[model samples]
Target: MNQFKKYPNFLIGFDRFFYRKEHKSTRRRILSIIVLILIALLVIYGILVATNVNRYAFLSLFTRGLRDQKQQQDFITNIGIFTLAGLSFGFAMQVKIFNIGISGQMLAGASFAFIITHYLAKTGFAPAVGGQLITIILSMFVAAFVSVLTGLFKIYLKINEVVSAILLNW
Candidate 1:
């Protein structure tokens, strides 16, 4: 078998990777799909790098994000927030209810929290971890309130949740 060395059309290599065996098992098919996707990503990255040298800085940004403690903390916080939001969305999905206002709710929650925190800080409250904890709690409460209001719209006003969510989001 000749080593596939085509530089321009990597799809040929992908084809060989997928169609190597006569009988493709489920595992082999999945493996081929994964490998093809990886190769495609590599080709796209190569194009980006070739088009602009500054594009390579994405690698450094990724590495720095991994290495930096503050960045890691921020990432973890983001993951936690998204995980909570995902769970809420999943619960809504399980009930066959679509809530498209998740991001808007979060924004409202954050804005409410900022306002409360600023007020407390102005009133000589310690702007420390305790303040942060209060802010988080208040933010979550505001988010829940916003979600409940959306639900109420769907329930009493006879508005479709998706339409209401979109309008509220706007």
Candidate 2:
């Protein structure tokens, strides 16, 4: 078998990674897909390196993040937040609804928590652990309520979920 090498079309550089051919093999198709993805990633990395702009931002996080305690914690915190938001989106998907305003809901919860904490501090009744627990519980409710607005708009006003979500995101 001759090695497939050809000058790919400029408009579609991965055209050489052929999908439709006489050899109808799953392995060949998978290999072609993998090669296409690798070439795309290589192009991105090359551009990043050539420009000398925050090269380590994409390539060196494994060692650097572990070396710094604060960065490691921040990474873990972000993972947790993203995981929860992803799960929320997945759950919405099951219901044929798109919850694009998850971040807005999170912001609403954050605002609720901040206001509650500030008010308690002003009242001279700072109940640290209890206050935190209550804030968390109430914040969840606030966020859930914010999410419900999208549903309400869809149900009552017949607004598109995407439109309502973008509106709420603002």
Candidate 3:
């Protein structure tokens, strides 16, 4: 029994080397080749960047100038709004609901938000920060609501979501 077990273990090792045809050296060589290719690609990219150093410098300067003038508060608010929109769409997808009217929903949401903001501004009851917050909240809510309504319509009316979504855009 001991001899039988030892013979099978030896044969397994032999099979790994000969039958399986996989060698440690071959694996090491493949790994080295991949590393070399990656290094070469990095070197080429560095050379290209160095050659166009001036052009890159000008582009960086132009972008930085624009960044300096952009309002930080507005940028933060926009990012928050977009994050909410993405989350809403992701949730819809998770529930096996298709939200093809995302673009139109977003457009209408923005338009409605603007209308609300202007109305509040005219009424003299809106603070600057408060108005912005309300606009962002309203935009996300309206957009998500519109997407849900479209999904419901598709399920209840047997209307194709794609056609309804496209027509909504028009």
Candidate 4:
């Protein structure tokens, strides 16, 4: 056999990596298809499980247990509140508004909600469950409204939102 014919000049370095036995490429292709099918099946299964109402019953029971536990209830509430605050802060930042007083705003909203709920309780105007719901709704609205006001002030007054928010908190 001529040397040139046996070893092609075009095959060199990393380019030669693609040169493999015929069966290797076929095996790889089959394996890739199998993996993709498995992944698709898993995603389908997850969607089926999530959409089924039976799964929600389990989740409800789990949530009820957490609600019955004072520590767990407080932990979850705190996490939710902080997560909302963080999201609001991020939104403010994206709009070129500084949100330096999220913590203070959250505290003030909670305090105001507590005061209102206390007054309602004393006046006998609010049922226990309804009062709790109103308190939560009012607190969330107050927090969101206060944050939006801070953003508006920053836009209208040409002042640093961070400074304005901090002052509002004080």
Q: Point to the candidate with the largest TM-score.
A: 2
Cα-based lDDT for every prediction: 0.82, 0.83, 0.73, 0.75
lDDT tens per residue, model 4, 1-170: 77756657556522333444345677666766687677876676677688885756645644664665786878788789789888978997898656798987888788888899788779888767876787888888888787777878877987787787788888
Per-candidate clashes, comma-separated: 0, 0, 0, 0
How do all models score by TM-score? Answer: 0.61, 0.70, 0.49, 0.49
Clashing pairs in 3: none
| Cα lDDT tens digits for candidate 1, 51-141 | 8868757577556666778989987898898997899899989998888899889988989987987787799876788868978888889
Give the 10-residue window scoring lowest on summed lDDT in candidate 1.
1-10
Q: Choose the strongest candidate by lDDT.
A: 2
Ranking by TM-score: 2, 1, 4, 3
Deviation from truth (RMSD, Å), model 2: 6.6
Query: Could you tell me the lDDT of residue 6 within candidate 3?
Result: 62
Residues 65-164 of candidate 3: C-alpha lDDT, one tens digit per residue: 4464465566667778789668867987999766767779989888988888788879887768876887889887987687766777688988888788
Give the better candidate number (2 or 4) by TM-score: 2
Model 2 ranges with Cα > 4 A deviation? 1-43, 50-57
